[model samples]
Target chain A: MNGWLLAATVELGGAGAAALWGTATGPLPRRVMAQNLATSAVCPALLLLAQGYGRPSYVDLALLMALLGPVGTLVFARLLADELLDDRPRAWTLTWAAAGLSAAVVVAVCVATGPSRAMVKLLLIGALLIGGNVIASRALAGGFRGVRGA
Target chain B: MADAVIVVALLLVAASATAAVAQREPARQALVLSVLGVVLAVLFTVLQAPDVGLSQLAVGSALTPLLIMLSVRKVRRQARAKDRAR
Candidate 1:
C-alpha cells in the first residue's frame, strides 16, 4: 500500500524465495545456514510490516522471531553436529550481511519513531536479532565444541 | 497495488510448504520446515493477524525443528545401539 508496506513486500518476497531455494536443495550444512538466515530475513520484514500497518504491537512478532530463530538454528546445529562436523558450515559473509540488514532496518524504524519506549523496544529487537544470529552462526561453525551432543 | 504484499506472502507460503513436503530426508525436511514456519509467520502478519503470527513464530520457528531433530537423533542412536547388540 504505502512505501513501508511496499518495502516489506519486496524484502519478504526476495528473502523468502532465497531461503526456500537454499533450504530445499542443498547439502546439510548449506541448508542449516539457509535456515539460520531465514530468521534474520523475516524479522526485518516483520518490523517493516508493523510500521506499515501502523501497529506497534505487531513488533512483538519480530521480537519473538529474534529470540526464537537462532534457537531453532542452534537446535539443528547441535543435533546435526555429526553430519555437519565434517563440513563445518561457515558463511560469515552471509551472516554479517543479514545482521547489517537487520541493523539498518531497525535504525531506520527507530529514527522514524523518534525517542520513546517503542524505540527502545526496537533497539532491543535489533540487538537480539544480530547477537542471536552471530551466535547461531558461530555454533553452526562448531565454535562451541562442548555443546555438540546432548 | 496494495495487495501486492499479500500476494507475495501467499506465494512464499505456498512455495515453502511445497518444498517442505518434497524434501526426502527428515533432517533436511526439518530445515525446510523451519523456513516454512518463518515464511508462514510473515504471511500471517501481512494478513493482519499478528496474534496468530506471534504464536506461529514461537511454535513454527524453533519448537517444531527442535522436536523433529531430537527425534531423528534418538531414533538413529537406538538403531545403532541395536546393531551393536547383535
Candidate 2:
C-alpha cells in the first residue's frame, strides 16, 4: 500500500474507533457530538480512499457524505433539542479539528490532481463538509433557538 | 498491505453495528445507527463498490436517522398529549 492508502487506513481506523466508542457510551449531547464527528472523520477518509484507489468516480461518495452527514446531525440536534438545550454540546475544538482535517485532505488531493474539474469538485466537497459541519454544530449548541419548538 | 484498509473498515462496521444493537434508548440507538451507516459506506467503498457506498451514505447517514427520530418524537408527543388530556 502507498502513503495515501496508509494514511486513509490509519485515519479511518482511529477516528472510527473513537466515534464508535463515544457514541455508544455517552450522555445525549456527547453522543450527538460524536455522531457529528463521525461524518467529518469519515468524509476525509473517503476522499483519501478515492485517491488511493485511483478512482476519481469514487469521490462522489465523499461528496454525498459531505452533503448528508451534517443533515443527519442536524436531524438529531433538532429532534433531541429538548434534551440537549440544557447541556448544549459545544465541541468547537473537535469541530475545527475535523474541518481542518478535511481542508488538509482536500488541498493535498487538489495538489496531486492539479487544476481541473476534479479539483473544483474536491473543493466543493470540502466547503460543504466544513460549512455543514459548523452549521450542524451550531444547531446542536442551540444557536438557532427560534426553531426549537417549531 | 492494501488489505489493511479493508480490515479496518470491516472492524468499524462490526463495532458500530454492535453498538447500535447495544444502545437501549431509541434516540441513542438512532445516533449509533447513523454512525453505523457512515462506517458501512466506508466499508463498501473499500470493497471496491462506490456505487453501493453512495446509496448507503444517502440512506443510512441522514434519512434513516431522521425517520427514526421523527417517529420517536411523534410517539412521545402523542403519549404526552394523552397524559395531559387526563
Candidate 3:
C-alpha cells in the first residue's frame, strides 16, 4: 500500500523466492545456507511491515526472528556436522549481501523512527540480524571445531 | 496496492510449503520446512495477524527443525549401530 509496505513486499518476494529455491533444490550445505538466509531475509521485511502498518508491536516479531533464526541454523550445523565436515560449506558473498540488506533496511527504519527507544530496538535487531547471520554462516562453514564430531 | 503484498506472501507460502512436501530426505525436508515456517509467518503478518505470526515464528523457525533433526540423528545413529553389530 505505502512505500514501506511496497519495499517489504519486494524484499519478501525476491529474497523469499531465492531462499525457497535454494532450500528446495541444492546440496545439503547450500540448503542449510539458504535456511540461514531465510531468517535474515525475513527479519528486515518484518521491520518494514511493522513500519508500514504503523504498529510498533509488530516489531516484536522481527525481534524474535532475529534471535531464533540463527539458532535453527546452528541446530542444523551441529546435527549435520559429520555430513558437512568434508565440504565445509561456505557462502561469504551471500552472507555479506544479506548483511548489507539488513543494514540498509535497519538504517532506513531507524531514520524513519528517529531517535527513540524504538530506534534503539531497531538498531538492536539490526545488530542481531547481521551478527547472527555471520555467526550462522561461519557455523555452516564449519568455523567452530567443537561442533564437528560432536 | 496493499493487496499485492498479501498476494506475494501467499504465493511464497504456497511455494515453500510445496517444496517442503517435495523434499524426500528428512534432513532436506526439515530444511525446506523451516523456510516454509518463515514464509508462513510473513504471510500471517501481512494479513494483520501478528499474534499468529509470532507463534508461528516461534515454533517454525527453530523448534520444528530441532525436533525433526534430533529424530533423524537418532534414527541414523541407530541404523549405523545396527550395521556395526551385524
Candidate 4:
C-alpha cells in the first residue's frame, strides 16, 4: 500500500520533470523528435508485455495513456510549430478536421462496445488528464506570451 | 521499497536541478536531464511501479530532449536575429 503511494508520488514527479524538461527544450531536432515520439508510443506496448505475469489495473491505464500520449505530443507539436498551417492553411485545417472526425468515431466505438467499468473509468481519467494538460499548457503559454508582450 | 524509492527520488531531483545549473550547452543539459530521468525511472521500477517508470522513461528521457532541442533552435534563431540587427 505504501509502495503504491510512493510509486504514485514518484510518478507525479516524473511527469513534472518531463513537462519541465520539454518546456525548457521546446521542439527537438526532427529525427530526435520522431525517435522519441516513436519510443513514447511504444512504451505502452512495453508495459502491456509486463502483464504476462499478472494483470495490473494500472497497466490498462498506462496502455490507454500510451495510446494517447504520443498522438497528443505530435498534435501539440504540429499546432505549436504552426508551420504546417502557415505553409498550407487549408490542408492543415482539413487534416485537423479529419483527425477530429476520426477521434469522434473512436470514442463512439468505445461507447458502443460498453467497456468494463474499470476500462470506462480509465478512459475518462485519461481524457481528463489529456484535457487538463492541454488547458494548463495553453494557460502557461498564454501567460508567457503576455509577459513577453509586455 | 517505499523508503528506498523516496530517497532515490530526492536524489534524482537534486541531480536534475544540479545538472540543469551546471550544464552550459543546451544539448548537454538535455542529456543530463535525461540521465536524471532514467535514474528516477529505475527507482520507480525498483519499487514495483513499472507503469510510472515507463511513463517517466518515455516522457522524461525521450520526449523531453526533443522539446529542448526545439527550444534550442528558437534561441539560436533569436541570437542570429540579434547578430543581424547589430
Candidate 5:
C-alpha cells in the first residue's frame, strides 16, 4: 500500500523474525531479551500502521503496546528472577537501536501530522515506548536492587 | 504489494504458534506464547482490525504470560512444599 504501511511491514517482519528465532531456541536470558526487543520493535511498527491506515484511533493500539509491552517483560523479570539470578540478560545495542527507531518513527509521524493534538499524542507514545523499553531492559539486567527476588 | 505485510504477518503467526507448541518447558512455552500473542496482534492489525489487535495486545503481551507464569510458580511452590514435608 503506502510507504508507511510498507515500512511497517518490513519492520514487523524483520524484528518479528529475529525475536521468534531468539526466543524459540536459546537460554532463558536470551529469550527474555528477545522478548523485550520484540516489544520495542512492534510498538513503532504499530505506530507506522496507524499512520499508514490514516486512522488516528488505531494509534491506541501502539499506545497500548508501548504501555504494556514492557509490563510483559517485567512480569518475566520478576517471576523469573530466581532462575535468572546468575546470568543477567543485557542487550543495550539492540535496545538502543529499537529506541532510536521508535524516536524516528515518532518524529516522522509528528512532522506528517503538523502541529496538533495528535502530534502530542504521538510524542507521548514515543516517550512511553522508549522509557518502558529502558526500564524493562534494566529490570532484566537486575539493575534495580529492590527487584531482586527473596 | 499490499499483500506482502499480510503474508508476513500470517507467516509469523504460523511460525510462532508452532514454536510455542514446540517449546519443552512451561516457562519457556510461556515465553514463546507471549511472542505468539504479539504476533497475533500485529496480524490482526494488518488485516484491518485494530480493535481486535488492541485487545489482543492487552491480553497477549502481558496478561496471558502473567497468568501462565503465576500458575507455574504456584504449582512449583506447592511441589516444593510437599517435598519439604516428606
Candidate 6:
C-alpha cells in the first residue's frame, strides 16, 4: 500500500507540475492531459491512505473518486466542447456545483463514521451514490435528446 | 520468490506508468498503460488476490487500453478533420 501511495504521490507531483505548465501555456490538450494525470493519481493515493492507516473506511474516498473520475473527465470535455460548439458558462457551472456537492457529502460521511461499520456503510453508500448517478444520467439521456449521452 | 516477483513487478509497473505519460504517440501511451496493468495484475496474483488479478487482466490490461486506443483514434480523426477544414 505504501508503494502504491508513494507511486501515486510521485505521479501527483508530476501532474501538478504539468498542470502548472498547462495553465501557463493555455493549451487545451495540455490541460486535458494534466487533469487526466491528476485524477488517475488520486485513486491510488486514496487506496494507499485507506490501507496504510488500517482505516478501511477511507474506501469511501475510493468510492467517491470512482464517481468523480469520469464526471471530472466529462466535465472537462464538456468545457472543451463549449469552446468548440459554443462558449457557454452554464454547463460548466452546473457540473462544478454537482461535483462539489457530491464530494462534500462523501467527505462529511467519511468523517462522521467510525472505522468498522463505517467502512461497510461507506462502501454501501458509495455504491448507491454511483448507482444513483448512473441511473439519473440514463434517465435524463432517455428523457431528453438535449441532455447528451454520457 | 514471491517477494522478488513483487519487487520486479513494481519496478515494471512504475516504468510502464512513466512510459505511458512520457510517450509522444497516443497508441504507445495506451500500450504502456496496458503493460502496466499486466504487471500490476501479476503483483496482485502474488498478493493472493486472484479475483483482483483477473479483473485487472480483463478490464485494465485488455478492455481499458483498447477503449483508450479507440478514443484516441477518434480524436485523431477529429483533429484531421479540423486541420482539413482549416
Note the DockQ of each predicted structure.
0.93, 0.95, 0.94, 0.11, 0.88, 0.03
> lDDT by residue for model 2 over B1-86, one digit each (tens)?
79999999998999899989998999999999999999999999999988998899999999999999999999999999999999
What is the C-alpha lDDT profile of model 4 across B1-86, one tens digit per residue?
43544564566567566756776777646645654555565456545677787777677755786688678767878999999999
| Stronger candidate by lDDT (1 vs 4) | 1
In model 2, state the lDDT of residue A33: 97
**Clash pairs for candidate 6:** none
The Cα local distance difference test for each model comes to 0.91, 0.92, 0.92, 0.46, 0.92, 0.47
Candidate 5's residue-wise lDDT over B1-86, tens digit each? 88998999999999999999998899999999999999999999989998899899899999999999999999999999999999
Docking class of 6: incorrect
TM-score to native of every candidate shown: 0.98, 0.98, 0.98, 0.36, 0.97, 0.36
Q: Provide fnat values for all models in the order shown.
A: 1.00, 0.99, 0.99, 0.01, 0.86, 0.00
Poorest stretch of ten by lDDT in candidate 6 chain A: A86-95
Query: Candidate 5 - CAPRI tier?
Result: high
lDDT of 1 by residue, B1-86 (tens): 88899899899889989988998899999999888888888888888888898888889998999889889988999999999999
lDDT of 2 at A150: 70
lDDT of 6 by residue, B24-61 (tens): 76654554464455446545654556467556655654
User: Per-model i-RMS in Å?
Assistant: 0.7, 0.6, 0.6, 9.2, 0.8, 14.0
Model 3 lDDT per residue over A1-150, tens place? 799999998999999999899999968888888889989988999999999999999999999999999999999999988799798889899999999999999999999999999999999999998999999999888777764464
Model 6: lDDT of residue A55: 56
| Weakest lDDT window of 10 consecutive positions for candidate 1 chain A | A141-150
Tens digit per residue, CA lDDT, model 5, A49-83: 88898998999988998899999999999999989
Candidate 1, lDDT over the whole model: 0.91
Better of 4 and 6 by TM-score: 4
Model 4, A52-118: lDDT tens per residue?
2244454543444444444444433343443322322112232233234323433543454467774
